[model samples]
Target chain A: MSNLEQKPFNVREIREEFPALRQQVYGKNLIYFDNGATSQKPKLVLDAINLFYSKENANIHRGVHYLSQRATTDYEAARQRIQRYLGARKSEEIIFTKGTTDSINLVAFSFGSTLSAGDEILISAMEHHSNIVPWQMLCERQGCVLKVVPINQRGELIMDEFDQLLSKKTKLVSITHISNTLGTINPVKEIIQKAHAVGAKVLIDGAQSIQHMHINVKELDCDFYVFSSHKVFGPTGIGVLYGKEDILYRMPPYQGGGDMIARVTFERTTYNELPFKFEAGTPHIAGGICLGKAFEFLETIDMEAAERHERELAKYAEDMLDTFEGLQIIGEAKNKTSVVSFSVKGIHPFDIGTLLDKQGIAVRTGHHCTQPLMDFYGIPGTVRASFAFYNTKQEIDTFVEAVERSLSMLK
Target chain B: MNLIEKQEEIIQEFEVFDDWMEKYEYIIDLGKDLPKITETNKTEDRLIEGCQSRVWLDSNFRDGKMHFTADSDAIITKGIIGLLIRVLDGEEPKSIATADLFFISKIGLQEHLSPTRANGLLGMVKRLKLEAIKHISAS
Candidate 1:
């Protein structure tokens, strides 16, 4: 068999890695296309979760007992793994968070609360609600201005417009490295460089990017980076925020409570060191520990090979769907991850999604949380099918067949 | 109106929805009859943060009744807002507080909304109730 056709890395072997992928949805073999929303967990991640609870379930950081020490070791080791996964310089730079939303909010409230009036925060038109809302709330509170860099018809960021939006007054430029709605992989390195030249911090939202691409934070030189663990085949309710050592040290604590404090008295208190300064209260301990297993699982795969395989499938799915009358694919970015958003003429996206679900070929239908992009396109929503490495060619074929069948019903 | 009376009013309003959908050419027409927000009153302060549609919301209390005027950039979303206004508009704070707008899942209106849109709708309802709570407490 040819490399792509070979079962070497096909769904059968890949399916074994993910316990959730074996189940049936609606009496049909579940074809999960919601990877962009959150990926299904692998066996390793699940085992890690089970293993943590079975052996080491105590609260982290404080107890001198065996369970607490082991738990602290596992949690910090997970942080170290993620640090290496993202190629961060130190483990101290990584802060465990609830997810990308929490990570962004942490930065906004902690870092953004310090900004002065007339300071500008630049973001793109295609940001998810999580990325957009936190900055807006910060702007409203801090008297800082929020500027948007527009995207072109193809859903790619207009570099000129982004350059135009950057200035000395810009305090931060937070942009999605890969759009969840559109599959566009942005030029984040250049975006970061331009922002940094003006003395502004840059936070790249990697909620969608981490799955498809290999990210090296040091190479990118982004001041801050955030991504949800769930999107990377890890457990939900856990994520990581990576900041440069200098910047993280200067930023204030996000939540004030236990574990984050170094010295506490009725009169005064001092915050803990680098990462724990931000991590307050009891965190999603099991989730954070399992996040390491997710990185380990991803490390085993040939990332380039997977990317090429999915790109080919995406293109094939695109061509097949294009054969249908009046079907338009949105966001045809030249460089993209494995996501396809499309709409059929004279049909609501929800109708198409419901029809697809009946056949067990799941897909997301709607704005995909980028409403400004939807408004720009003048459509109510688009049906989005996002692929992961484990997704098969046969699944794409089934998806196309289902789409055709669904369209016929609309007729 | 009392609890039983409000439930009856809701049942009647749902019955009128079919007729409203047919008679009105656009969702905004339904909105036009529900309430109004004068142009001079438009501000960024009233803009909802996360909605994909440009939803303009303005509220005022007149004679113990809360009035809301909302307009969306999209038609279906507008229709949804119209449905919300019909259910939520003009009701007293405590009565509107007890109303289950999520019950639209039973009527199958939310069947069409994506999870995100549904969440947005929920957020809008929460904002409306928050406004009501503000006024109710002030009084």
Candidate 2:
């Protein structure tokens, strides 16, 4: 079916799917603009959570009992669901972790431990601490050098610089596919191609990318892609680390415990196969099961249309914020997701955020765990208002009005 | 070590947090009371990196308990740092280990904090806990 031929998503029907959207905060209908951090759960996802605990709440790959068998089936089914969602060739490529932070740490410990001294790991300056810190730790321990590809004033990566950084010593090229702070959509396909030209492995931090638009891992051909479930309208405590089978098979287990082992002996223990090798302890069963439903919920929507709507909202937000005197938008990327970052000249970002919260509009104000990016901009922090498809133009209007009210206080 | 006694003590202190305006007013006043750190202590090494406000924390462990003296460039932040020292400074290493500091919710401070400031508080607490953990492990 053609992408245009697809039916438009029913916003009311979709809004009904998320019960939390109907909530009242401070006697006003809650305006949730924090979708970049973590999205609200849909009814299907929340219901799946309840259903799993009520019916099939048993540990996977353990017992011959009916519940255990059922649980194992559901759990593996969730992996397959994710595989289809990301367009991965095989389900075995998916390794579930706590969140994006845990997934990055796994790669750092498992694959990064193999990197020797003088090896270089290249990452972009726009990466979240989750993406940057793990590699920093690896560099510190292994003596592997850490290098960053710089971004321009508009928050876009300098492609030529990134190419120059990728050389024989470059072991890995890890970068965020979409910058959380700046809303800059990076060229991952081009990045992967250039990195591979030098025989370097590439890992795309999809924590911000997955929600903005559709992704096909097979098409990108990156060595690995990582994302958090909570950011994609699923529950917390679960994330996916998607790597090609051969790569995953070569990597060592991150954490050793009950489930990750194939055989246990005081003398020599054998590790479990593929994905199980990475996932240790009793898994987040309910969270994993609900995440399958969240993926299903997203799949039913018209992603391209949703992307267009978000872009429209972002443009409107930007135009509105531009009118204020001494107000500067932090990232003016021509291509962006639904995030708007700005700083007021005289007022502190915290004071602006606090004043906005009085009008029941929640916005994030800080370095956003991107300290290096903040330093690059030479600003303390920016007030960030991120939008989702479910958000409306009216809400944007409300947001702008609140900013005007906040400006009066500053003056 | 008695669970009930500890719970009662925590609860008693926790109740005073109502009317955050009043509590924060008192806290800001307390911050005002602090003698500002000398210019020599305000170097890059003293600055806590993740904080929204410039917080300088220096500690002395006396008789097996950690004593932290902290100040921030922002007034309310300085007050909160002072409150943190009052709650955390004299506690045993193990007591600090098992502490349910998420009770920032119960005390209504969590709601008052901008997510960033809440994150700052969390970072502050985490740093303090790590110091206690280090002390416990070394001993």
Candidate 3:
């Protein structure tokens, strides 16, 4: 069905699905704006967690028992669900991981071995440490050159610089789809096409983008896409790494363990198939299942409306905050998501965060794991208010007032 | 005043503030009043590690007592360091090392000791006591 033909998103009803929103902190209703760090779990995801532990508790894949078979089915079904979610070609392309960090490390170690000295891996300046460090380690190991595509003052990537950086020596282009700190929605489709034209693969970090908007790997035609489940209203400790079938089949196994091996003898051990080869040991079975439930929850809502609601909330907060003297919004990207990071002229972000916490408002304050981005702005950190669809305009009003009050106390 | 008496004084002072805002205001005032650390002592070696905010602490042993001068990038963290120095600055190495710091909880600043804050207050306390221990062993 067309997005317009689908049921319109109801914020009030959506808010009801998350039990965490009904709580009070410091004698005031909690205003959660830390969705960038991790989103609050909905009832369906919670129920899936409980149901897996209560009824379907068993080891997967190897066991022939009833509960074991049920668990394996659920686990594999979760992979298929994620496959459909990302519009991946095959279930084998969706490899369950511990989180985004682990998934990136897997690719760095496995796909990275294919690279030799003098080969280049290109990444943007606005990448999270998770996306940056793994490639650094890969470069250090393989003696490869790591090239950085710098961003402009507005936190948008300089496509001209990226074009200059792309060359035959460029083995891979790993970049974030949406920056967690700046909320800048990067042009990954263009980046992927450009990278492929230069005989280079691209890995899109979807940790921030998966929650904010729809993503189809086939449409983007990225070599790899990675995201954590927790950031998308699912449980922690489980994530997905969606790689192209041909690329994954060619890459070596990440970890050695019982599940990842097809045949093991004292002399030699042969690895398992496409997805299993990457997945080592007993996985986060319950977390994977519940992550599937998180996608199911998203299916019930009109994502277009949710995306619009989040953007409006961010714009509303940004406009109100701009009116205050000495308040500088860090990122002013033309294409952005729901994250609004700012810093007061003279006041430290920590003090503002402390006072806002006392007022029962939750906002993330610091470099936000983007220390390089902070350095680019010539600041220590920023106070970031990230919105979700469940958040209301009323909450934004309360937040702005709290920030003003906090600034008054700080100044 | 003795260390315990000093802590009691702080508790009494905080009790006057009925809300977190007033308490925080008092802390900010304390931060403003903190004695500036010398430029030479603000070296990289003097900087305390594992805190959310950058804190530099330096110590001197004089007349069998430990003198601590500290500063922080964040004002609230600076205030917290001031509170620590206020109680332990002039005490003997043994006393400074052994004395329990009860003023933190009494002033409702226990949240600063949380893991999310990276247990920065506890790290500061540990560093201070370690300095005291070094002084005790040196002389």
Candidate 4:
């Protein structure tokens, strides 16, 4: 069925599923617009967390007992569920990680070990520090070159510049699918194709994209995709790293520990198979199982409606905020998601954020870990209000009124 | 007034405001009344690291008293620094070094200036006392 023809979903009903949305903060109704930082947990996700610890608590993978076998089954089932979620060919390609940061670091260390001095890694200007630092450390250790593809004033990646940066020397092109700060939906599919033409691998950071839109690894043809569970309305400290099986087979194991090994010997220790080889130690069992529950919750929602609702909330906020004098919206890309970042003239973003917090409106302030992007804009930071499917137009109105009050007080 | 007496006085003043809004307005007013530090004094040596806001503190020791001048990029943080300066400035280095400045919690500003605030009020206080220690030893 076409996206426009999808069945309508009740946003108010969806809002009720998230318990955090029904609360008062500082004598005002809490308007949480910081979904870009981390989404609020639904009741199902919360229950799953409790159930795992209460009823199904045990170490996974190697236990032959009932609880161990049950835990192992649940954990592996989570991997399979995530595999289907991302449309990967096999469940073995999904490697459980601590988070997106841990996942990227795994690739940087494992895949980076194969590189020599002259190999280059190309990243975008708007990458989070997680994506940037690991590659920089790799460059420092292996003497590889780290090049950044710059963005335009609208926060969109410069495709021509990306094409220029691509070459045989470009061993990998690591970029974010959506900018957390800018909310710019990057042309990652096109980027993947272009990078592939030069025989370069592409790693898409889906930390912001996984929850907002549909993701298909096979359709995108990306070599690697990484995202955090917390950002996708799941438990923290668990993430997924999807790598092509052939490429993963070539890379070395990330950490040396119990589960990632086949046999331990005095001289030589044989590593385990594909996914477990990278996952070291006893993993976050509860986090893994609850992540499956998160996906199950996601499966119940009309995702197309959720996406449209989020976009509508953002546009409503943006339009209202634009009417306020001296307010300039940052990252005005043609294609964007549910994030509105703005700055008022002659007022600091911190001041606005503080005032907004006092009014029970939770928006993010400062550079948001994208200091380089802030430098490009020639500002210290912007106040950002990011939306989720559960957010409403009434909340946007409340937020805009709060912003107006804050601007008046500050100005 | 003595340091403890001054802190108690500030706490009593804050007690008049029942709502956080009024209290924050009072703090913002205090921020507005703060004396701006001279541009030359905003050197790297005078800057406090690990603050979310940029805070520059300058001190001079005269007649065994430590005179402090400070400024912050954020207003609320400036007000906090103002409160710190009010209780400690012009005191003897020994007194400044040992003063507890207990009014922060009494006035319900513990969250804003606590060690975990990340706005670096705790670090600023530590640096101020360290300066006092240096002055006391020098004297």
TM-score result, candidate 1: 0.77
Model 3 alpha-carbon drift over 4 Å, by segment: A1-6, B38-41
The residue ranges of model 4 lying beyond 4 angstroms of the native Cα positions read A1-8
TM-score of chain A, model number 3: 0.98
lDDT of 1 by residue, A1-411 (tens): 001222344556777888777777656788888888889988888877888888889998889999999988888888998898799999999999999999999999999978999999999999998999999999899899999999999999999999888999999999999999999999999998889899999999999989988889999999999999999999999999999999999999989999899999999999999889999999888988889888878877777788888888789889899899999999899998889999888766765675577677778888887888899999988999999988988888888888887777555
Clashing pairs in 4: none
lDDT of candidate 4 over A194-218, digit per residue (tens): 9999999999999999999989999
lDDT of 2 by residue, A307-351 (tens): 998999999999989999999998888788999999877556765
| lDDT at residue A388 of model 3 (Cα atoms) | 93
Instruction: Give stretches of model 1 more than 4 Å off.
Output: A1-11, B1-139
Q: Rate the local accuracy (lDDT) of all candidates.
A: 0.81, 0.82, 0.90, 0.89
**Of the pair 1 and 3, which is ahead by DockQ?**
3
- By lDDT, the best candidate is 3
**Interface RMSD, per-candidate values to 1 decimal:** 8.1, 4.5, 1.5, 1.7
TM-score against truth, every candidate: 0.77, 0.80, 0.97, 0.97
- Model 4 scores a C-alpha lDDT of 0.89
By summed lDDT, which 10 consecutive residues of candidate 2 chain A come out lowest?
A1-10
Q: In candidate 4, what are the lDDT values of residues B60-130, reduced to their tens digit?
A: 89887899999987787888899999999999999988888789988888887666566667778889999
Worst 10 residues of 4 chain A by lDDT: A1-10
